[model samples]
Target: MPEPHLLAADTDRAAVVTRLDESLADGRLTLAEYEDRSARAHAARTYGELADLTADLPLPARREPARREPARSPVASALHGGAWHGAWGHDLRAAWTGWVTTAVIVVGIWLVTVLGSGDLQYPWPVWVIGPWGVVLLARTIGERRSQDTDRQQLPA
Candidate 1:
């Protein structure tokens, strides 16, 4: 048996219908599509029938629970973990890469201005360009940190 909160039948069916109607009225759903699906959902007598009405809608793919048994070998476990782990690791690495690349460019410009035979002066091109590089690096890092914080706050 499922928990009462998890059962659709235990919910306010009228409220669900009202939400669907609002979606249609707000242009989130086309009138023709809404009417057709709403009619199907209304006429449904069983859980399966109601599910079928919205089966064609795109939904976020669910992650399958890991198996506890040894039906799968150790290699399968390693491979499964590696796929998603690598993707998240790459994302984190890219953020650092951006910061490092920006810093290198800034340093290169500063060195050229100081060591090279050029009139290095305040309010010059290098002064303006150098700080912009650091600003970009800070912005990228801050944005990524904020996004990570937001993701952490969301319910899994």
Candidate 2:
């Protein structure tokens, strides 16, 4: 690397200003000193002049890149229709089978209750089935939208 005194003033001035900004915040530089140093930094023509402004302050730490979720695969979608058909480790087919089996059990109880009483009663199964159906509908819509979004953005 070239000596600090040999570097161009304007090229490294931002780095010095940033350090000066920190010094001001840390009470190392008063408002007057900060103002004077900031002006000198911008007007500096040599790297030596710029370096003089914040020689006492440490350099800012380097930042790490952000982490993101793994990208969804098209092959996974084509094979599965949707990746999550079941909660936990179960597939969609199993989820549907479980739901259907539950519905049958609920209806069977309602039927036996009505028959035993020998009186007409409201179809109370609607309360259970109605909400279950709505949840399925929402899941289906969300999956469709996700698939569409995947289609729109081609992987680089």
Candidate 3:
């Protein structure tokens, strides 16, 4: 550790002030005591002076590292849990349901036009379906690859 007589940086002063704030919040220090200590903390010129401000206070509790979870796209969350968590298949099914529903609606419209005109209309629904299907297929492929990668990462 560096010598306590060494000059303190703004960060050192700020750390001491933060502890003073916490002490005040916890009712360990009255407002007058906090104001005095905080003013002294900002004016402190050495690590030793800063340390004196909190020397009698208990150490702050250690904070746990936050847990990591898989990142999900907005579309994926809507499918998996944003609408309702754990009641459906993972994001995959929800993603496809949208494309399938739209495809059915567009095809039904095309069929109606063909019947009314008594002639084959150009298969127009393919315009709506094809690109969307390709996108969903690509997303499915990526999702599968990620699942495979996750499975491999697990210990045998």
Candidate 4:
């Protein structure tokens, strides 16, 4: 008959494998580390050995503790100090494209309006069309860039 502890350990192995898998998915453990640790966990024949594998992981840290302290980066400090802060992380090319498109649409609408009626009036088409198109294009570009970065990081 199998020892009760051995049976319990075998059952607990599934939980350990689950935890290891989650860590691997979240990038906390590299692929190699995950495979090695998973193999060790699977080979463990006793509850004590399984427990030992998880002994080093701390309980999750509280988010409140992190939020209580103000961020100390120079950029953050400058923002807090009332310095003129431009939009951080904005792609200038994206912004320029958006502005240019907006301008073009506005001009096109103005021309249409002038040809239809000889009056300077706000163009609704410019407001409706330009911003969304530019935003979509920028998001597509950003997604591709992020994918490229991920591909580069993967072990060749």
Scored by TM-score, the top model is 3
lDDT of 1 at 69: 40
Candidate 2, residues 71-90, lDDT tens digits: the string is: 56767755776565323222
List the candidate 3 regions with Cα displacement exceeding 4 Å: 1-90
lDDT, each prediction: 0.53, 0.70, 0.78, 0.63
Candidate 3 lDDT by residue in tens digits, 75-113: 887886342232222555645655776888999999999
Off by over 4 Å in 4: 1-9, 60-156
Extract clashing residue pairs from model 4: none
The clash count for each model shown is 0, 0, 0, 0
The segments of candidate 2 whose C-alpha lies over 4 angstroms from its true place after superposition are 1-90
Flag the better candidate by lDDT, 3 or 4.
3
- Candidate 2 vs candidate 3, lDDT winner: 3
**Can you rank all candidates by TM-score, best first?**
3, 2, 4, 1
Kindly give the stretch of ten consecutive residues in candidate 3 with the minimal lDDT sum.
81-90
Every candidate's CA RMSD: 20.1, 24.3, 21.5, 18.5
- Report residue 45 deviation for candidate 2 (angstroms): 92
In lDDT terms, which candidate is top? 3
Model 4 scores worst on lDDT over the 10 consecutive residues at: 82-91
lDDT of 4: 0.63
* Candidates, ranked, lDDT: 3, 2, 4, 1
TM-score of each: 0.26, 0.38, 0.43, 0.34
